[model samples]
Target: MNIAGDDMAMGGMHDEGANKNKSFGERLVSWLGRVHTMVIHFPIAMFIGAFGVELFGLWRQNRDYQRAAHVMLVVGALGAIVAAFLGWFAGGFYLWDRNPILMTHRWLGTSIAIFGIGLAYLATTYRRAPDRSRTVYWGLLGLMTLAISVQGFLGGTFMHGGLNHLAF
Candidate 1:
């Protein structure tokens, strides 16, 4: 209820963005934003795990490992969709020009989500991929995994006030 800076000065309310006038859906989204950070880890872990197992599968020439990777990729893609949706809520709607870090993080996360889903579809569609196509798929998965790492870095930079957060 206290949307003004005065109540925040007294440590009365933690959420300064709260608005009593907001509709049910609006408030729901605002509340959901708080869960974004927690949900993001699921997809990141899933994707990284997928990439690692895929590499091991290729190295060992194992069909089991490849199947596991495909499953992981699908799950990771689903998680990414949820994480990115919550992230949009977390970052606020269309404030792209107002904050550079948020903008980059937001778009990058979104791209990953889109790309992840596409990759998942392709992976599922071509379960018994030929050698060449499978190779290209693995390469794309590697790139997506790399992008996830960069997204994590950007998120940290935004939260901890830039790249010097780890300064000695």
Candidate 2:
């Protein structure tokens, strides 16, 4: 029962054959590399911008700066989601359990991803009727700031500590 000019089952034939064609290790490595490339980078830029805007807003006490920071935080959160997915996939596929650091990294990455999603939701909702709540925006910004800091620290721990210490 070919449906799209392909002689393969809807869910099995093509996928099974494809899997059989490539060694599992090779496939995993390829997938990890691809997802890693696709997900990393944007989050770094967005978060950096978010941090900057927040600092500027605090210094200037300007509503415009605060709004800009919120926008960047929302964008950064989206990027973090993509990065988290790829990082998670890579960790799982590679069985990155040799060190405790990997677990810490995973937890921190997940936290950042979740926080970002929340921030994005808040930003979207707020955009519709912006003047509704200054407290909400400020609260979200504070959370974003904390998330970014924690993510950064965890990333450093992943790179340097190799999961040796669980101290936060």
Candidate 3:
């Protein structure tokens, strides 16, 4: 076990070529972090689905929509927490030198995970609330939708280049 090699690899192993000599632990962490991108899709889809369901439910005045939204929120929140942990591990690989964009992405990811949990809890608690309180429920769902959009943009910028770097 080469401790120095592990330490160096963990610092900033950016590409497959650079990872060639990484220690098992270093590689394992990096691999886990890489899973973040794949797993993120689940939460994205779930949260969006929940919002849509709630909206349709509201429009149709059906209690079934709220129940469906609750299920989606719970699943989405759990998925977000898992993805966030993976993101934290993957993000550590880029922290050798300060990258403001990465830091912003990390913080935003964490916030989203925390926010998702809160949203899920609220949704479950109020799932059976009277129609009079639907406004507050919808408001929270709207906030989560907005947060997801902002987080998606930040993730894109962090993964690709910043928006300013776009050709058009």
| lDDT per residue as tens, model 3, 1-110 | 21212322433244677578888987898788777778999998899899999989878978887888899999999999999998877677453326666677777778
TM-score, candidate number 1: 0.82
Q: By TM-score, how accurate is candidate 2?
A: 0.62
Model 2: residues with Cα > 4 Å off, grouped in runs: 1-25, 28-39, 58-61, 93-98, 161-168
Candidate 1 vs 2: which has more TM-score: 1
lDDT at 153 for candidate 1? 90
Candidate 2 all-Cα RMSD: 10.9
What would the per-residue lDDT of candidate 2 be over residues 61-126, giving only the tens digit for each residue? 765775676677777887888888777655553434555656666777778788787876776676
Query: Candidate 1's error at 77, in angstroms?
Result: 0.5
lDDT rank, highest first?
1, 3, 2
lDDT of candidate 1 at residue 121, scale 0 to 100: 81
Looking at model 2, the pairs that clash are 101-163
Look at candidate 1 and give me any clashing residue pairs. none
Q: Once model 1 is optimally superposed onto the true structure by TM-score, how far is the C-alpha of residue 140 displaced, in angstroms?
A: 0.6
